[model samples]
Target: MHFEQQTPLNAFLNILFDRYQEKVPAVKKVTDALVAQGVVKSQQDIVNDHIAFRTLGVPHLGIQSFEKIFLHHGYQKRDYYYFEGKKLNAYWYAPPSDQYPRIFMSELMVSDLSEQAQKIIHRYTDPIQADPVNGLNFNDGLQIGEFFHRSLWPLPSKHDYELLLAESEYAAWVIYNRYYLNHYTISVHALKEGYNHIEQFDAFVEGLGIRLNTSGGKIKVSGDGLLKQSSTVAEMQEATFADGETMSIAGSYVEFAERLPLPEYADMPANQLTPAHRRNGFETNNADKIFESTYTGQTKA
Candidate 1:
């Protein structure tokens, strides 16, 4: 979050966003459009609500291993969320300080999946006898940053990729894009008054021709009505399979979140309100649909 100084944490987060932004065209497209609209002067002017990553729930590689990088950087693990239908588990981590974006990490529940699906996942992951994070020099930020993009296992064959896709699209995604950032959010509430609400923000994004994930309506609202979110359908990339065959597959995307003031803080003026005054954590139902931003239904819609 604080990149002015080259601290290990800063280097790590900076590179993550740099690499992610470079690969996901939507990230720059959204930011450029916002700037043109007078939403903010530059990318740094926009507050990041949170960032998310997807993992495979296999030995030596699920949330337990993936979270060490952030946890070591002073993030405190927070609420847990389970997606029964998706066969996954997730948790959101609070940053050391509000200046940093919260983390939402999810893992595909390999065991809960069909036997064939589990077999497909393990075929690659089983070779990782030890958790890779333990071997890294956590003191070096660039090393840790590189670890996120490093391959833990060889790419799965195209047949295996489709086999897993048939069962869990998440599994197929993780197999190829391991440890890559799934998405980063722009805090819509932090923008100017007219652009500080979900409806207006979504409309503006739509006007720019950015396709939104429509799984749970173009905008997903929490039951408490304090957290409203929407995301662009993922960018599709042409991927060459291990077998030399290629296909356009889903990559990362961009998300916009508007966290309204909590009931007790509803009377507080905008100038006085801080992140503390808004909804704090993610909602399971909202996330359930947000996960589909990279899904076939949303991408193909």
Candidate 2:
């Protein structure tokens, strides 16, 4: 399910509420007034405690681009999570203190390829049919997007790992026409050993016939605030497509956010009745005390 236009960040929460009116009646009253239209059908399990929605596979223009778009619609970035366990990215959004249920986006993954795979990618390069609207090539028989994330996660063994890595370049060529940007990042563990540093990332992307667009910083950033100035000779590669689209992605990195505890106290408040009620018609706090005390050979204290 894809939204035709950019979803206003403010109204997204209301949209979520309306989708579950029967279960969460508290929201229908508020969501009814908002005229924000729906572009996709409610296509997930709607239950008492949770809801899920399918996301459109469109690349955001940039981080600042999303911030400006969402902020205007009354949404502030509440929290974000990068699930290293799943190799996925996610974020949470609050509805400006005016909406209910809030909104969350997750299961984000990125990809990069190996040199042997780059040769295979050259065979499927078709820049002419790439749809600028979605930044994807409008071609059939490619069946490539299915394979993009296949290699993103680490495989069972290094042999299988290299096998998937070898195929990613061709997969990119087919999927590249359908999506404007490809997400690339080395694992946190990999970076610790000075492996596949960002400079190498720049050169590797160019080899697949794309240009590194570093201005957005969407593809490259050190999770730590380390600044390094280097004149070390950097390897160069080219990322040009058949239709003259050239880009080399560099410096965009992802960091997972820490988790926090739930507000259990707010959900269940404390009782305030004091000892003064003991003398009146107040009952004991024990449910069994009033039942069969004689049969059990026990007396209330």
Candidate 3:
């Protein structure tokens, strides 16, 4: 269901989360486990730190085009991040108000890829001569939700996918999953007693049989130690390719983040703190590893 004109921001976000949960089994599984452990009374009590999206650096799309939806909904561009190893550029947007989650959008530098990889990507995207976002009904929440789940290009052949995977797993993921929700992070610090930190929550999740992404260690902490993050390895789903072949591939997963209160606010009572009182932006070092949640090496059974 889409959000109506009078829908509050919290209600609109609830709709998005419901849609995401329906498509991403990992989200529900994790949420259910948290509830069972008494970390949260229900899924609604789990504060979302942020949600991320992956896009291509093609002509019509990219962060430039995709960000309009959130911008129209009151988000403002904030910090810019660069991932040299992955050839990616990203930005984290601040929500209009504290009640909303932050946004992280990343785009692949297709030109940075090898010629063979670029050609394969262009084969599907080259057809669209104009920016697709121009046609979106930004005021219609339902339309925007569908846009997030819609496929912008045809499926790639398994061979082409493998080629892209060899060079950049990020490229392979965006090419096939196009516009799919990458992951939604739970604000672990906001949880009830015993599970308010990443260490505690990570162990609790693992106890429920969830495998986490361990590329840069299971828990990626910021240099300042104010932001800690962890994510489950993506669950595999069968994806049908252009060649009529189907294979199990990694889909979306869930993430947990514990944004510590700044040193100045460490002694303040919880009621005195606000969104700004905590670590408010993302950490590149931590995010770089979080992106590997969908890599074949990490997702393969």
Best by TM-score: 1
Q: Candidate 2's C-alpha lDDT?
A: 0.26
What TM-score would every model get versus the actual structure? Answer: 0.98, 0.26, 0.94
Model 2: residues with Cα > 4 Å off, grouped in runs? 1-68, 112-301
Better of 1 and 3 by TM-score: 1
Better of 1 and 2 by TM-score: 1
Cα lDDT tens digits, model 2, 203-291, are 43344443323222313222232211111111122344444555431111111111111233223322322212111110111101111
Cα lDDT computed for each candidate against the true fold: 0.91, 0.26, 0.85
- Ordered by lDDT, highest first, the candidates read 1, 3, 2
Least well predicted 10-residue stretch by lDDT in candidate 2: 251-260
TM-score of 2: 0.26
State the lDDT at 29 in candidate 2: 22
